[model samples]
Target: MHQLEADALTSPRAPSFIVTLYGDIVAPRGGVLWIGTLIECCAAHGLSEGLVRTAVSRLVSSGRLEGERIGRKSYYRLTDMAEEEFEAAARVLYAPPPQPTGWLVTLSEAETVSTDWLPIGPKAFIAPRRNDVLRPNAAVLSCDTVAGIGALRDFAAQAWPLAEVGAKYDAFLSVFEPILAHVWEAGAPPGPEALALRLQLVHAYRHAALVDPRLPEAALPEGWPGGRARALFVRGYLALTHAADQHIGLTFHDSRGRLATATAATELREDRLRRECLA
Candidate 1:
């Protein structure tokens, strides 16, 4: 295995990696994958066939996947519930860096805030005002500037685990920066390798980006790594998509045979990422 691939597959676990594979690759390509294809892909990550089977069974039991048998073959796809979750995640993973739209502060003395909202004080919480995020029902206020910039940043640091999140972003950069360099020098990798690297890139970035509170620039600590990480992800993913999609078309399968290389959904995502890269 390439050192980069080895680094990407560190502490590989079957279930979450499979979810990453499905969300990044299969979900966009009709959301169904044959078990054989699943096993083959997981094998590249050092997961055994038995482990992959067990993981798939667990995902089905947990309602994240639903399985179908066509002849002697088994195929799995994300359940509707899982699809909704993955769709929300996809928006974050693939979309461009969001513009600062201020913050939504919600106050509710009677009800508890959702995990999505960071609790800033008793009965008060805050979250970035993005279109994808549902607004919480409470006494809500939109604030572009909460206080002095330094104080607001301090308050943000106190409310969210910015240090920990920054560490995650730093880790992502450490892993992917070299991979990006390799792509730049040697060009896109082979089909299967390209697919693996792309999945790992998304997996690593998602680990950091999803946990991020995604506060506005004024609210974030100076020298934040998140923007740099986002730029790297966008560039690397776009570089790999052509080769990676070729691998997906040739290798991945469902009851219906090979997966589509390009769909409206896939094209739209590529377009958005391309625009983001230019932006």
Candidate 2:
């Protein structure tokens, strides 16, 4: 078996893998899935029924999921709080490559900084500009590059864990590159395998991409693997969607009936990813 397939079968925890399922599949199909369906899906990743139940219960308690029962069968969907969080994550995972905005530099008297802000030095942090970020007790300044792209790259390497993030991208490429090659040479795997592969692809890429500071290309090291990884993710995901959707249509269920195989929202998401890959 391929290393990527082995990793998919062995590496995921019940809770995070279930989150991946909801984010990638269940959410787009109306955000609810029957417990039996959830268990069958999780079993592909070697998660036991009991483990899935415990994880679902924990997710409900933690405000990430809510459960309902119809007579004897149970179903779960994301909570409002979890939906908001998932939406944020989906933007990172599905949106096109971010354009290079100038930096937001913060000067604070506090010793520590929010995880969103990268520590450049003592009492100072920097991040990509976003309107929503709170810079409490800090003088925030928007910076435009006057000169020295090299200097900015060096500073970014130090401030953000670029090397570590690069390693993650490298690992992602190692796993998915082979799968993409196989898909191109042959075809997508069978429906069940396709669904499992698609979920694993999202889970692995999300792990690497979310932690990325997403610095401007000029500010990043030469030949960064992030762009390559993003392209592969888009291509591989789009390639598998047909078979995976077939699996979902046949196997996924909720209280009302079988979940949608594709919705308008899911189609838009595919279009966006296709545009990104082409661009």
Candidate 3:
């Protein structure tokens, strides 16, 4: 004759908020936050319910989270592997760059702009359109339209298909580091001109690689790159340039006469990153 046990279950919010909060908790490699507790915690951070749910579903599917059912309640926590991986990612995200001083804000207000077309060197516009003459420097010379295509070709030639892609990332970053260093050294207006061109190319390649969908579109031109890897590469490439336009005031003038607005979020991030605007 034991009395019936009272049930303990937390009310559910929008699936999206749940997922995103779960990710925030797990992403820092911290302790498991009870689903009930997490809702309150994340609400303060302004995460939406939809984003939380989406994040949770993604983590579960990706094997980053585990749930334990207890009567009417379920408790979820990050797995050890997820903890390790997420912590590593977090370290990279917050890692301090060599130059902590901000120097990007001194450009004239007129110099700051964002647009759809890629900004190019007058040389790129005037240089003979001979694609054959472009030599591979693996760093400073890599451009979005051509250098990116060559990266794919180099990747294809690798014994392990992804090896050259990894190499390309290393090479590109190596080039980017020096450009950033110079900016930290000389400030914005007088920084080496080569620094801007190199930054543009790197930015272009990064965005071109990452801006596209994670899934390949069937309609891509003949000899299309496929699979998640290629899609992610395209996304990175596009996102880089998008960041520039939104933050650094870059305008892209493509074959078509059109302009795309820079994202306000990008501008905010730049405010934090650039020396001139830091609060």
Candidate 4:
């Protein structure tokens, strides 16, 4: 209901798909989805019942989900671990567009990259976390905590590599541009098609977000298209909230009450905020 895709409910695996189902449908209002409902929904996407049964068994064995038996019915919901994982993932998955506040990385020669942060520069890799820093050799010049403006384009090129990640953005824009255009044409007021498209857009954009390094606009190659992609995503999703709400109502079987309260669905929801790949 919160601009997530049921088909994309996970990150391209059975477990991830289950995670997506939990996060997208179950976690929103902190409720459970019945086994039958889940099976039916998954079937709509061509997931066989046997696969669903296997995935559920695997998830329960790993403690990511808990199955509950209520009288003659069965249901499933997120376990604490899944809830925590989804919470962390939701922050990144629904993050606002990239706004890389330039990082100042000081490259000191290191013998090993075993530290919590990834080593970059020379033998090191980029820092894994935004706040991570390397232990200094002390023999080198004092490091600057902020990224230097000089040759940032080159730094980005060497570090993040424009070819693959840049292609990801290009692919995202290619798919979404037409969808956004259609949203403009259809105007406001949501419909089933809009909701379906919005979920699809979120799913596709999430994949791109995972692939992109999310470098600062200044550091990226000339004619960077992330801004365009973000703008298009924002436009397409906002216009489709009506459609998403329409969907939730129909899916949940309580059409009027949901429609009345669905007003809150348009709160500029976002995920995957960090330029994590760059950091």
231-279 per-residue lDDT for model 1 (tens digits) = 9999999999999998888888988999998888999999999998887
Ranked by TM-score, the better of candidates 1 and 3 is 1
What's each prediction's TM-score?
0.92, 0.87, 0.27, 0.66
Tell how far residue 266 is off in model 4, in angstroms: 7.4
Compute the lDDT for candidate 4. 0.56
Residues 1-279 of candidate 2 have per-residue lDDT tens digits of 345467534558899999999999987778889999999999878899999999999999999999999999999988889888888888888874465577788887555456668766787878776554556566888987779999988988887889999999998998789777877787888898888889989998998998887876778899899989988999999999999998899889988999888998788888899888877
The local lDDT score (0 to 100) that residue 90 gets in candidate 3 is 29
Off by over 4 Å in 4: 1-18, 104-117, 121-150, 187-192, 253-279
Residue 166 in model 1: shift from native, Å? 0.9
* Tens-place lDDT digits, model 3, residues 132-217: 22222222232223235455345334422233344444444444445444434554322222222323333323332333211112
Which parts of model 2 are misplaced by more than 4 Å? 1-9, 106-115, 118-125, 129-142
Candidates 1 and 2: which is better by TM-score?
A: 1
Question: Residue 73 of model 1: what lDDT?
Answer: 91
RMSD values for the candidates in order, in angstroms, are 2.0, 3.1, 22.6, 7.1
